[model samples]
Target: MAPKAKQRRILVKLVSTALTGFFYTTTRPRLGEKLAMMKYDPMVKKHVLFTEGKIK
Candidate 1:
């Protein structure tokens, strides 16, 4: 039998910068840096920058 390896991915919350209370959950590499991307926000009806936030 082989021993189990540690997880390399973690769940992160991407929050909209528009302050519309919109967010998305996704898995990412366990890097020590934050993630950010541009996505469509239905609340604002436009694309906006989404920054990484703690899942808790």
Candidate 2:
């Protein structure tokens, strides 16, 4: 039987830093540091920093 291939990407939650209880979902490489980006938040109506978080 062929060996099972490893998953290179994972689903993660990006939470807004503005404490607006807003978040986003995206796929990223499994082997790397936590992801962070600037995204628009509808709650605040402005761009904010989003940090990676667990899906659970």
Candidate number of the best TM-score: 2
Report the lDDT tens digits of candidate 2 across residue range 1-56.
99999899999999999999899999999897889999999999999999998998
**What TM-score quantifies how close candidate 2 is to the native fold?**
0.86
Give me the runs in candidate 2 sitting further than 4 Å from their true place.
1-5
Candidate-wise lDDT, in order: 0.94, 0.96
TM-score, cand. 1: 0.84
What shift in Å separates residue 21 of candidate 1 from its native position after superposition? 0.6
Write down the lDDT that model 2 would get.
0.96
TM-scores for all candidates: the values are: 0.84, 0.86
Q: Which ten residues in a row have the lowest lDDT in candidate 1?
A: 26-35
